[model samples]
Every structure is written in structure tokens, then in C-alpha cells.
Target: MSRTSHICLMAEYNEWMNARLYEAAINLPIEKLNANRKAFFGSILGTLNHLVVADTIWLKRFAAHPANYVALDMIRDLPTPTSLDQMLFTDIQSLSEHRKSLDQAIIEWVHSIDEHDLDYVLSYSNMKGIPAQKNFFSLVMHFFNHQTHHRGQATTLLSQAGVDVGVTDLLALIPNETVA
Candidate 1:
């Protein structure tokens, strides 16, 4: 697959997995969602919130790209997360709504960019104010990989709480190919 096609696929997978996770998460009581499970982010809600925070931070940075992606314009208005663990929404319902919006924006943004845009070396500062320049494509990969990594943590946490997120695999979203 082409680079843009791959990115578009990842974006779709992101939305798909998030919908499943949130649907499962919403079935739990608020207390259960907030309960600290000793996971990296503390709880299911916390881990999910971290994903939103991190995605917001990255999306804001991406909005500054020279291509001027219209889909990311909404991200520019979002509050910059001060920490990775910052909770944007205290409850699953509110968080799920925002996640849907963000996922849609991500899908639009990926579809808006072509392979040429991915070659640009994006310059941005890290959360610690450290300056760095890196390839945009690699950064986008990190963006999706980061989500998958934390979502795995969330799935495990949910499973412990007896809420299975079912089929948390990117392979499930890949289309079957037919030989010509």
C-alpha cells in the first residue's frame, strides 16, 4: 500500500478500536471507571483520558504543518494538555463524545494529506520544551502506535474489570486482497 493509504488505514483502525473500547467502557459505573487499577495511567478512564490528551497535543502540532490541513483547524482551539496524564473528561460518556470528534478529525486529517506531505521534516518542541526536528511520516506512525500501546493497557484494565473490549487487533480492519 502507498504511504497515504497506510495512514488512512491506521486512522480508520484508530476510530474502530476507540469506538469498541468506549462502548465497553461506558457499561461500567463511574466509580469503576475512576477506580485506580495500578495501571500506568491509574485506571481505565485515566488511560483513555491520556490518549485524548496526547492526541490533542500531537494534533495541535500537526495543525501547524505547512500544508495547512483544514481538518486539524479544530484542534488548534483545543486546550493544550499540560501533562500526559491530564484528564480531559472525568466521565466515560463525555470522554467518548470527545473521542468520537477527535477520531473523525483524525480520519479527515489523514485523508487530507498526500504522500508528499509526509516527507516534510516537522520541527516542534516536546512537552519538556526540548526542540527537535523529525520526519512527519515517522511522527504520524508514532502517533498511531502510541494510541495502540495505551489502548492495549486499557483493554487489559477493562478485562480485569470484567469488560472485554473484544478483538483489539489492527488486522481485523485490514481488507482482504485478491490476486489479479
Candidate 2:
């Protein structure tokens, strides 16, 4: 698949998985969602909030890219997350709303760029203010991979709590190909 096509696929998968997870997560009581499960982020709600924080941070960074992506203009108005673990929302409902918005922005942002845009080396600093330069396409891959990693933790947590986000697989979203 072409680079842009791959990115667009990932973006779509990101939104689909998020919707499935959130739909299941919303059924849990507030206390259950907030209970510490000893996972990386400590609780289902905590993990979900971390995803929002991380996505926001990355989107903000991407906005600084030289292409001047119009799709990322909304990200400029989001509050900059001060820490990776920062809880942007206290409840799943509020967090899920923000997640939907971010997912939409991701889809639009991916569609806004072409294969050429992915070749540019994006310069951005870590949250600690340390600067680094990296290929834009690779960074975008990392963005999607990061979400999958944390969502795995979340799904495990939900399973422990008896909520199943069925078929959490990117392969499920991939289209079949026919030989010519």
C-alpha cells in the first residue's frame, strides 16, 4: 500500500477501535472505571485519559509541521497536556466525547497530506523540552502504535472487569485483495 493509504488505514482503525472500547467502557460504573487495576495508567479511566493526553500532545506537535495542515487547526486550541498521565476528563462520557473529536481530526489530518508530506523530517521536542528531529512518516506510525499499546492495556483491564471489547484487531478492518 502507498504511504498515505497506510496512514489513512491506521487512522480509520484508530477510530474504530476507540469506538468499540468506549462503548464497552461506558457501561461500567464510575467507581469501577476509576478503580486502580494496577496497570500502567492505574485504572481504565486513567488509561483512557492518558490516550487523550498523548494524542493531543502529538497532534499539537504535528500542527507545527511546515505543511501547515488545516485539519490540525482545531488542535491548536486544545490545552497542552503537561504530563503523559494527566487526566483530561474525570468521566468516561466526557472523555469519549473528546476521543471522538480527536479521532475525526486524525482522519481529516491524514487525508490532508500526501505521500510527499510524509517524507519531511518533523522537528519537535519531547514533553521535557529536549529537542529531536525525526522522519514524519515514522512518527505517525509511532502515534498509531502508541495508541494500540495502551488500548491493549485498557482492553485487558476491561476484560478483568467483565466488559469485552470484542475483536480488537486491525486485521478485521483490512480489506481483502483479489488477484487480477
Candidate 3:
């Protein structure tokens, strides 16, 4: 598969996983959901928030909307999720919708992106004032990876909160790709 196509498939899988994650968190009790389990991103809410923020930033960047964050601002604002379960529910819904939008964007880009494009470096300075450059494909992969890492942290915090989330794996999403 082409690199962009591969990432789109992964994004589809990620969207599938978000549904399960949202279901698991729906009735987790507001108090427990908001409680700090000291996960990698600090709290459950924080980790979720971080994932959402990354997605938002990437969406903006992809659309060629001017970038809005600096490295330090990003560092300080990582994963600032809300404590309320209801609000979190809304955020998850928004995330799912945004995933759809992003998938469409990727499809459009992949129709034209080629081996030469992959070699062309895109440069931007992160919040730390450090310049970074990588192939566009690498940057897209990093975007998804950043979400996965924090989701792992959030899942850990979920476990510590005694929330029994059955099967966090991507294969579990839309089983067989038919009924999912």
C-alpha cells in the first residue's frame, strides 16, 4: 500500500478504537473519571485532552491554516483534559467527527503525494524553539503515534480506576470490517 493509504487505514482503525474507548468511559462515574491515577500524562482527563489537542493541531497544519502553538506553550498545555464525564463524552464525539474529516483530507493528499514528496522536508520549530524537519509521511505517523502513546496512558489510568475495558486492541474494532 502507498504510505498515505497505509496511514488512512490506521486512522480508520484509530477512529474505530475511539468508539470503544468512549463506551468504556461513558459510565465510569464522574468522580472516578476525574480522579488522578498518576498516569504518564498526569490524570486520565489530561491524557485524553493531550490526544485531542494533537489531532487538532495536525488538522490545522494539514489544512494550511497558520500554526497556532509554540513548543513551550505546547509543552505546558499537554493533555489538559476536563474532569467531567459528560464533557469528556462530548470531546470524544468531536474527536470521532474530526477523525472522519482528517481521513478525507489524507485521502485527498495521498491521491497526489509521491515518492518525491516523501523526500521533501517540511520544517517547523516545536515549542522548545528547536527546529524539526521530516518527511511529511513521518510527521503524519508521529501525529497518530502521539495519540496512541497518550491513549495507552489513559488506559492505564482507567485500569487503576477499576474500569474494566474489554479488549483495547484495534483488531477488535468493527470486527471483520463488516459488522464493525
Candidate 4:
């Protein structure tokens, strides 16, 4: 496949892993889910919420939307999106639906941008009002990396909470149906 196709696949797989993590998270009690037991980021709920926000902000960035630093702070205030008792019945139903919608939207936006657009420099003044130069391609890569980094933190919170979220390895995305 082409470079864009490869990127799309990677992004799709990342989205899938994130969906699975959300599934594993809601299996526990609300007290456990919201517990201040996470070793970092204070609470498991808060940390997962951060991942959701990061994805949203990066999705905006990837789409070449206005880069607003203020939205980054809005993650914590977004509310507990998962229902605990309902999760026993719903599993990851709600979270999976949202993730699927977001993932599809990302893929579509990426398809709209040509490879030439990747090199175009996007100059924007930061919250400090200082001008900064970030290549669209480089920033896009950072967006994906940011998702992986924060999701890892959420994974840690899950593990600490005694959740066995099996198999985060990327190679697992390829099944017996070989890519080659």
C-alpha cells in the first residue's frame, strides 16, 4: 500500500487498542474505576479521560483545525463518560461507538490531505504569543506518539487496578492473513 495507507492502518490499530483498554476499564466497580488509587495522574478515571481529550485535540491538529491550547486543559472537566453498572451489561458499547466514529473521521481527514500538504509548514503563535514553526508532518507524527504515550499511562492505571488488559503489542494487529 501507499504511505497514506500505512499511516491509516497504524492509526486504525491504535484506535482499536484504545477501544479495548476502555472495555477493560469499565469492567470494574465505579469506586475502583474512580478510585484515587492510580500511582500517577491521581485517578484512573482522570487518566483515561486525559487519553480521550488527547485524541480529540490531536484529531483536530491532524485535521489542520485551529490549534487552541485552552482545549488541552478542558480534558479534566469533560465528565465521567463511562457508566459502571451499565458497563456490566453494555461492556464497551458506548466508548467503542465513539471511538469508531472518531477513528473513521480521522481516516477520512487524512485521506483528504495530499502528501505534498505534509511538508507545508504551519506557523502559529503559541499561547505565549511567540511565533513557532512546526512542519505539518512532524506535528502529525507527534500526535500519534502522544496518543501512545498517554495511553500507556492509562494502561498502567488499569494494571494497578488488577485489570488484565491483554496484548498491547502492535504486531498483534496482523493476523494469519499476512500483509505481505
lDDT of each: 0.95, 0.95, 0.57, 0.62
Worst 10 residues of 1 by lDDT: 160-169
Residue ranges of candidate 4 with Cα displaced over 4 Å: 38-40, 65-97, 125-130, 174-180
Worst 10 residues of 3 by lDDT: 65-74
lDDT of 3 by residue, 20-109 (tens): 566666566666766767665466655665666566556444433123223223233434333322233334445455445544554444
Q: Each model's number of backbone clashes?
A: 0, 0, 7, 0
Tens digits of per-residue lDDT, candidate 1, 1-180, equal 999999999999999999999999998998889899999999999999999999999999999899999999899988899999998899898899999999999999999998899999999999999999999999999999999999999999999899878898899989999999
RMSD of 4: 7.4
Candidate 4 at residue 105, lDDT?
62
lDDT, candidate 4, 1-180, per-residue tens: 555555666677777877778788867777776778634455666666555555664454444434322323333233433321122122234555666665666655655656666677777554345777888877777767777777777788888889878888777875466668
Residue 134, candidate 3: alpha-carbon lDDT: 66
Model 2 scores worst on lDDT over the 10 consecutive residues at: 113-122
Local error of candidate 1 at residue 132 (angstroms): 0.7
lDDT of 3 at 41: 48
**Native-to-model Cα distance after best TM-score fit, residue 58 in candidate 2, in Å:** 0.5
